[model samples]
Target: MVRYYGIFFQEDGQWSVRFPDAPSVNTCGETVDEAIEMAIDALSAMMVLGRKGREYGDPRGYEEIQAEAKDGELVFPVMPAEKAMEAYRPKKRINVMIPVDLLDRVGEFLKNRKGLDRSKFICNAVESHLQQNVEAH
Candidate 1:
């Protein structure tokens, strides 16, 4: 679990949220709840990028933030929602060898579908198979 400190403030009739730990991440919404939800997505995306080798800025100290916050600004603790984190997590690449006949059959099956690549199709199929087997057990 990763936690970061965020500042929530109103700007031009919209609620905006930004994390001190990651200045590059920010989001805006019409309501405070929406803003918080968007902030979680933004934070999770940043975490995903960081895991994929992106550098982030240093986090500000609480005292520094206390001294820096202006009127109407509120400090809020933010954590990435599990769903967001899972959805945004970086994908890993793997090498696999398949029989030529099977590969041709898979390609023929995907020919009618638009934008369904082999890797995604195989990943989804494996995941579904695993889920069904686990549930059966």
Candidate 2:
């Protein structure tokens, strides 16, 4: 339900969008409509990534953003879909106890798998086990 303020500018027939609140977030498209769509995507992605670094800026009021708009710039308010936000929900950390031998086996298995880590391996294993159990039932 959070809202962000953005400015859209058209140049040479292409449209570009930028968030005043978040200087690091911006996108462009062939048309104004397309630019708005891309802006939503970029905003949603930044929202997810920002949670990790905790550095995303806060949105300004409508009047404030509109007043700052320059010539040929259109001020727009964007609200990211709740579903999109939930889809990129942050991971939760939890502690687990495992036997020493199994821990060693996990480490050895990960050593052979490039770009795979203990967290991903464990998550996949647990999901697979749950799927099998559900299917059996």
Candidate 3:
């Protein structure tokens, strides 16, 4: 196992830092990096706090944090906007070819003839055919 430090940032931009297995945690930094730096700076304060009959709680014991950090991955368990955007990106287009007789039949069904293009008509026919046949099975 790798032994180093743990770090986290608060909503108000304060940093909390601690060793992997230490009771005395430190609160440091203004920005995240600064806060993390401060967190280590405040490590001495953690030891002082312990001397004054206080304790820093183990944060990972909380079920929510443990669940989120499962499998070495951060699972936020919340469907926020960033996650949704990553999930909904567009798919690549694909091309397909079919028989001449089927393509000709789609062409024959047009009313205002010139504006009705071959590809659009064939796509509609293929979609209809797939829907009907797929549901039958």
User: Which candidate number maximizes lDDT?
Assistant: 2
Worst 10 residues of 1 by lDDT: 51-60
Sorted on lDDT, highest at the top, how do the candidates line up? 2, 1, 3
Judged by whole-model lDDT over C-alpha atoms, candidate 3 comes out at 0.46
Model 2 Cα lDDT, one tens digit per residue, 1-137: 68998899987789998887888888999988988888888888777767455566568799988988899899888888665665566799998999999999999999989867998789889999999999999
Q: lDDT for every model? A: 0.81, 0.84, 0.46
* Residue-wise C-alpha lDDT for candidate 1, range 18-100, written one tens digit per residue: 77667778899999999988998988887766734546655666776656678889877778888787677678888899999
Which tens-of-lDDT digit does each residue in 16-127 have in candidate 3?
4434334444354566666544544444344333425555353343354544333432211111133233333343567767688876676576756875576556656778
Per-model TM against the reference: 0.60, 0.59, 0.27
Please give the distance, in angstroms, between residue 59's alpha carbon in candidate 2 and its true position after superposition.
0.9
TM-score (C-alpha) between model 2 and the true structure: 0.59
On TM-score, the leading prediction is: 1
Worst 10 residues of 3 by lDDT: 72-81
Give me the displacement of residue 12 in model 3, in angstroms.
2.5
Using TM-score as the measure, what is the rank order of every candidate, best first? 1, 2, 3
* Each model's backbone clash number: 0, 0, 5
Colliding pairs, model 2: none
